[model samples]
Target: MWDAHMHCHFSGDSDASPESMIASAMDKNLAGICFTDHLDYDYPNEPDAFLLDFESYEKKILSLQQEYDGIFPVNMGIEVGLQPHIADQNRQAVEAHPFDFVIGSSHTCDRLDPYYPSFYEGRTEEAAYRRYFESILENIDTPVDFDVYGHLDYVVRYGPNKNQNYSYEKYADVIDEILIRLIRRDKGIEVNTAGFKYGLCAPNPCPQIIRRYRELGGEILTIGADAHQPEHVGYAFDQIPALLKDCGFNYYTVFTARVPVFYKLPD
Candidate 1:
């Protein structure tokens, strides 16, 4: 399996080196892995916190790609925090780099990240959740660059109730619109398994959303651990193939030079 979304030292929030991450993937017996470090430009509170030094970051991944060519495939990718206003900057970043994949994610709503308590301040959980979904629509409406939308329901992981009161049905009107819009754009979404690590007992967007994406004819599904450490590389991957099969997916996706490559799901 391919762990297409991950972070290392190149990502400001992670201190893990690429070498350590690669070693973990190799140990996990993963078919391949991608270094999709954070590149959230104009991040709140710390503007340059998630910015990348593209020259050096790309250089490191390219070297590993060559060194491990026969042993494992190392792909270079980026996860850009999507917001409506930074659409141009996000596009330029993708256009300027030779990344194999790009994950467009909504890390904030109205310039505030739900990851922080402040984002939840003075708002009902349902209201905040709706705003987050709406922000994703705004990002999609803009000219953003991304191969797939990462962690469709990431905000719930930080919610006060944390999915206890959340359901796809509660937000179906907007969530369906998001899925339909992405399908129309030829974009896809990843089954981010980080939710399990976060104690959600389900992946982000939940199994319901995954099934719904398939029901809507959305086929480009990618699975990722969203790991920032060595041990977490390919975390819980053993469960994914079957989980995806039950979601009506016959195949999973990976990317090379920004092109989707399909692999049959195992029984």
Candidate 2:
């Protein structure tokens, strides 16, 4: 019932307002939503991309939460772009704010924005993908105190083949390493439904990876539409409960004040 990850005008890539997005979620029969606006510390995005005015932004969301008090909980959250150099800054920002949920995401590697094609220059797709994974490993190695890693296989969404030949069997070693570390550290992953919107035919991590996470004893899985606009709020979520159950999970996780709370998957 909670669209755990979404964006608004606060996110560099989205121009939708938070109120409009919340209304759309309500229309979809959602109980709540977390505004995970982007906070990419440094990048080449336009109009000062990936930056948030923490003070102003916090005040705005807190006000919005008060406005929607009796209607539903509008949780304050952020999608942080994981850059090793900015990890400390990120920590400080989170400490300064009252974010209910934080999604650590990798939008770049080797100082290159993967959203652009240049990231694939001078390397095979496999090497590029490996480097992206390596960057994620490094960020997580920052010994992240984050709740969940967003879009584990996000790189695949922009790959030249776009998951046409993508298979868990192909990337098992590194993927397993990633999953194992997350489990060992008590962190979790999200079922980012954005992949379906991106025409990837699956979620950001896809079912194969989700099943592997469950198989490896990783239990704190969360679900998020990752919607950047109002119309996309709670997109294709009714299908996720069965998808999650098939992946060996009966409940999905949520957060409040960074504490995990599990809710049974809907029938």
Query: TM-score of each candidate?
Result: 0.99, 0.96
- By summed lDDT, the worst window of 10 consecutive residues in model 2 runs over 41-50
Error of 1 at 266 (Å): 2.5
User: What C-alpha lDDT values do all the predictions have?
Assistant: 0.93, 0.87
Candidate 1, residues 170-251, lDDT tens digits: the string is: 9999999999999999999999999999999888879999999999999999989999999899888888888888889889
On the 0 to 100 scale, the lDDT of residue 164 in model 1 is 96
Give the winner by TM-score.
Answer: 1
Question: Measured by C-alpha RMSD in angstroms, how accurate is candidate 1?
Answer: 0.7
Alpha-carbon shift of residue 204 in model 2 (angstroms) = 1.0
Compute the lDDT for candidate 1. Answer: 0.93
